[model samples]
Target: MAATAAGLTGSLLLPAAQAAKPARPLVIAHRGASALRPEHTLAAYAKAIADGADFIEPDLVSTKDGVPVARHEAFLSETTDVAKRPEFASRHVRKTIDGVTHDGWFVEDFTLAELKTLRTIERIPQSRPGSARYDGMFQVPTLEEVIDFLAAQSATVGRTIGLIPELKHSTYFARLGLPLEERVIATLAAHEYTRRAPVEIQSFEVANLRMLREKLGKRANLRLVQLVGVGPVKPSDVAATGGSLTYADMATPAGLRAIAEYADVFAPPTRALIPLKKDGRLDTPTALAADARAAGLRLVTWTFRPENRFLAADFRDGAGDDARNEAGSIAEMRRYLALGLDGFFTDDPALGVKALAG
Candidate 1:
């Protein structure tokens, strides 16, 4: 018990000069202060960096021309003005991605030039009315644009900001002849800043992370993170290949040990670390944190949002589900931090900063 508690912090032996500064958990901005700004925009990334995020996340999807763009998913209907654009009305089509069939305009169906003509919008407008007001105000950004923007933001902020880009639906993209791994790597290598700065490539799929580990080798500033899903869910890649490995299997000590062979970090949804009870209050802490460390993996989770809907029951108040309860949100995070996370993702990085401050 003591060992698990101690190891959960991921405290490392540092040189005497560095030992004076305690290692704090990383504050990762989930889609760039997405609680406020239209996600995956320069405005959102800027807000996150300004609010003191150690890393900003960009979920990568490829366009028809094979260019990687920052978006939450391959589908464009929820997060863009594509549905309202007259020229793109004919582009609507149904396609099965990772087993789910959706009828809508997909990023993979549009070229980068065509995609740039569309603007970003809030995915959940009812919960974030303020963000919805900025609908059609920001352009969908390419990975190159995001990298360049991060480089510029780093210079202007006088701090070393980092990038954590997740290769969304890797298997799906690979099937479309628009495989993202090499293109993303090429883009990263092209940028001088990305070459030197901290770049963590994340994915829910296993093959891509393994491939990245083999192709990139080990780098001082680069890490490969494996994002775990809930329950017996199999990763898209594993599912596509008809493999039987479930995320539940991956959460096991043996599974994590296997993951440690290729990936630097093991990240799952927050509940996987500490599950909630039937009543919505937090249940007993799961052994996931301890198990990951036992397997030689760094621990992290996604995400922490400021709204009551996303808060743990212990933190939510009389305020409705959509209400943004800053105090409750911070409290929820602090409770989880007590379990000794190496890092965490949050929709509002300012609150993450505040939660870390104490």
Candidate 2:
């Protein structure tokens, strides 16, 4: 088995009563086994759980009827078969989400029944031919349905399967009267499984997590994750409120300490922890993991994909960039795991599981 990271190992030494058994760095499925399956479907999530993921991510967007459904973005063109359907051709239009104007069918314009008719597709077919094979085979699943499915999966698998639900575009959805925070809480509470399951609610925004913390207080099974985006982009909530706070500011020690007031986890993109040199090879690591731990927050990172294109130069093979390179991906993941990270998200949980198993 892979050794526990020094950063996380110290956390495990908390009094036995103060902490549960050792939580080996978690392997969270990024949009299910997304590198292989059309993301956000039951099939994708089921595959992730089977591949030994500790948590499955569901990026939540809202419907016209105000139901929260799984999607990478509110736009329907990239990940669904919406464009191929003539019946909904009129639904395509330009809409602004977090300042970016996307021309497509927005999720907020479709009802649950309407969305049910649209099947999910691989967002990038050229890079993920395997996932494209399953495109249009699975319907969009609701948060309630996802919880039900996870409940059944957990029982069958004989372990607690957790959920890491990202609240997508909090400010944008709120302005449209399809607020996500309340709906997520209501849906989680309504499910017998999610009520006790390890649920980590994450968001790129600031205010909503603070709001959620104020409303829910602290539950042993519930945690909030603050996702730090790269660069100087301000959180949507912050921008909406005319605040100048950017993700960079939040990544600082002071900001991380503040985040500890409302969140248990501090997650940034993988490169933020280990930067890539101008040559695309791995470069010196930032003090992010140590800084996060210093602020009493567990550090996690996003996205390790089993493709040469996404791998750092140190791990890539001579094979063209788009080719799947499981070996390279696993080696890259292990390198970061050695940095003492508490958890990470990956597009292929099987690779993540293998990397952790040593």
Q: Pick the candidate with the highest TM-score.
A: 2
In candidate 1, residue 242 scores what lDDT?
Answer: 92
What lDDT is reached at residue 225 by model 2? 92
Cα misplacement distance, residue 202 of candidate 2 (Å): 0.3
- Candidate 1 global TM-score: 0.93
- Tens-place lDDT per residue, model 1, 1-358, is 1122122112111111211111789999999989999999989999999999999999999999999999999999999999999998999999888777989999998999999999999999989999999999999999889989999999999998989999999998888899988777777776778766777889999999998776556666777899999988899999999999999999998999999999989999999988999889898899999988888788899999988999889999968999989999999899889888889999999999899888
What are the lDDT figures for the candidates, one per model?
0.87, 0.88
Q: Residue 171 in model 1: shift from native, Å? A: 1.0
lDDT of 2: 0.88
Tens-place lDDT per residue, model 2, 157-233, is 99999999999998988998989887777777656676567888999998999987665666667778999897889
Of candidate 2, the 10-residue stretch with the lowest lDDT total is 9-18
Q: Which parts of model 2 are misplaced by more than 4 Å? A: 1-22
* CA deviation > 4 Å runs, candidate 1: 1-22
